[model samples]
Target: MRKFIQSIMLLALSAQLFAQSSDWVYATMTHESALSLQSSHPSGIVILATEGNVSAVQIQHQLAPSLKSGNLHGPGYIYRTDAQDAVQALTKNAPKKFNILDFTITEDMFVNEVLGMVSQENLGNTILELENYGSRFHTTSSGRQAALDLKEKWQEMAQAANREDITVELFQHQLTQQRSVILTIPGTEVPNEIVVIGGHLDSGDWSLQTNAPGADDNASGIATMTETLRILLAKNFHPKRTVQIMAYAAEEIGLVGSNEIATQYNNQNKNVVAMAQFDMTNYNGSSVDVGLINDAQFTSSELNLFWVELMEHYNSTGEHRITYGTTACGYGCSDHVSWTENGYLASFPFESSFGEHNPFVHSEEDTFAAMNNDASHSVKFVKLALEFVIEIAKVSTMSTQELNKTDIQIVVQNRDLIYQFNSSNKSLNSMAIYDSSARNVLSKNQLNASGRISLQGIPSGYYIAVFKDNQGKSHSKKFLLK
Candidate 1:
């Protein structure tokens, strides 16, 4: 009787192993990462092929629960297709060797002007608005609406700036209903070279139809990007290299959106210079203010060094000083992995260390109130992003040549506004100040020859000073009243 029972159990186990459905999906991940997943749940994963340090595996959709749970705990796998396809993709897009650009600091004044416009209130409001959605999970109706709403918001901002060069569009994917959003600002000088800054917009939990307020997991990251876009448009800033702000969809489900987009860009032979991903930027669970992922397999050492140098030069010491430490998120943790696999230089600046990430992520508990209902932590990331864009995509001379030629300087000191011109040919006829919302606060039709005006009743905050020259051309500068 004991022998018969053993045989029956063995037969059942074999049947279970071979009875898997044809709904299996192919993916490629590091050998170590694949082994870790299989060791944790032997019945959930199967390795199909291996080449060098990478392995291709066939996974069932039923294992989504395990994958989602493991994402909250340890490293995750990179999703791709068939073993042959995976190897071919890797070979076709093998990373090219190139020299790192010269790290220099020549745009201090422009960088400072943009960094001063960072607002905590704006970031918090964005987070609140995104959390109001039912769920941003892929394949859901709400997820698709969220993407459409964001597209409209970006289009409105571009219109307000009166810029015809800026274009906003939705990137549709074949696998998921939720579409990714892309806002492109065409470069003035180097239109071929591209720079990308992105974060995932979709959120998830155990249930797809119910509540899954992923405020900290990803809403925070999207908020950071939105605030950056807001300030850049308000300042009427134009870059020399094409800059794109991408809000990817379906990141929670094995980086599906980003992988498809990256693969397409690679196939087109797009010249993407560098990419940066901001995911989970609100929660401060670690000792340091910023955590820079230093994994060489999925990140660029040169890119990491560039950010470190930026921090040392721009945010070294002050009330807004940001301290950073190195960390690693195994393999295929976020959207940055997608870009890295496509032979692009990408970097991820995380909110906290690996083991110290937010404990309430991927559930209803990941709400704004869970992080003390504040966006102060995200302010640092906004500042860092400003510095990155200003340095990488230097200001375009075509758009600001008039102002550059005039060389006008405006300063506010002790309730008095002073203006000076390095070129004697330029003369200021009228001056006005506008708030960040583009509302004109104070205006003066006539000005004294001494180039001074009294700001007696103006409040202390961020404002843009617009000066009209004798030629009827306008020049603006951002200033803070303290």
Candidate 2:
């Protein structure tokens, strides 16, 4: 009851800041990047601060009650768009990125404090940032120019880091600045089919601030996403499908990064299966105590709920109460929105309660202290987010009906079954057929829209038909020859 009341108080205290939409937030972020060209050691110093411990299921569980309560101020509004922009957001965009300011600050504070770098000596100025982006173009030309300039600064910083031993160089996809990172623990029979876990690395601005250190805005997000990647990688268990972890870029600037990569795969029409986003998973507002709470409360129906259900495979957090699609919300700010917009079933793991939203996002204040913390189960929080990405996001979940709608359809001639299209999900496209040892069969081939082409002659016998679907989904069924 005390916690619930505290949550109400926090909401009442921060009502002014939490009312804005993500669209406004993105522009505000770019404004900050444009204003201050900080030289924080390496370019995109955001890359250097990675704790690799955000995936903790226990942590995720402890935060949900707060998430349910903090959703009041957020109405989960929707955005109206023209056909062109919708197409781009949903299809053409790919290669997203995840922000990690919260983790960075906490990790840095701890590391430095332990290293004896406390108040003794002066630490340099930290580059503050904020984010509310979904494909760089969502805002305006001003935002674009700002992003371009920020990129230039980061490039300069990254180049400088290259000269230093502390820098770890990684490739960024040319179009969206996205990086492809895959984690695979070999599958038993189908090592080719994969379950991908991912998040975009970027931030948005609501307005222009001189310093925009997106600590809670998304630094927390990337921290959780990366931590999830690390946990899955550390596990020795192998599943039926390979699990790939992708940290996308250009998410804040616009869902540009993830959209780019996802669209490319969509164009190829491969089975990307499902996608999940760890956007703002660090903050847990006050409404944690479930016993007492009035009608006025905040709630979050983001990707975390799905994650909670997914965790049932392991052991913990069995029930939750919130699941709103990105479209259900007004705008697509985070990278998961990119996947959802593109017609893919993607999830976003946002903060528990955004009531005490990050006031310092676009300013220099987006550091760790400005947001809420569940405190009890931080690691669990991170783990639940990833569990959803791995299980719910897997390709095998798709049904046979979804397969026929793709570029490839089932084709059968005589005793031969063939797949006539390409897809990323290997399980759906795995070929299956049955035939008797004494049966005589004729030749077969996949024709145009007509489907299967049979040879002139064939023998009567029982046989099974098999073929791959558009998303690389495969299926088989038995047939009686007459």
Write the residue-wise lDDT of candidate 2 on 4-83 in tens digits: 43543354334325433322211111112222212221221111011121110101111111222333211111121221
Best by lDDT: 1
Candidate 1 C-alpha error for residue 302, in Å:
0.8
How high is each candidate's TM-score? 0.76, 0.42
Q: Which candidate is the best by TM-score?
A: 1
Give the Å shift of residue 458 in candidate 1: 56
The TM-score between candidate 1 and the true structure equals 0.76
RMSD (Å) of each candidate, 1 decimal: 14.9, 21.1
User: Looking at model 2, which ten-residue stretch has the lowest summed lDDT?
Assistant: 53-62
In model 2, state the lDDT of residue 297.
11
Q: Which residue runs does candidate 1 get wrong by more than 4 Å? A: 1-23, 61-75, 87-93, 205-209, 398-482
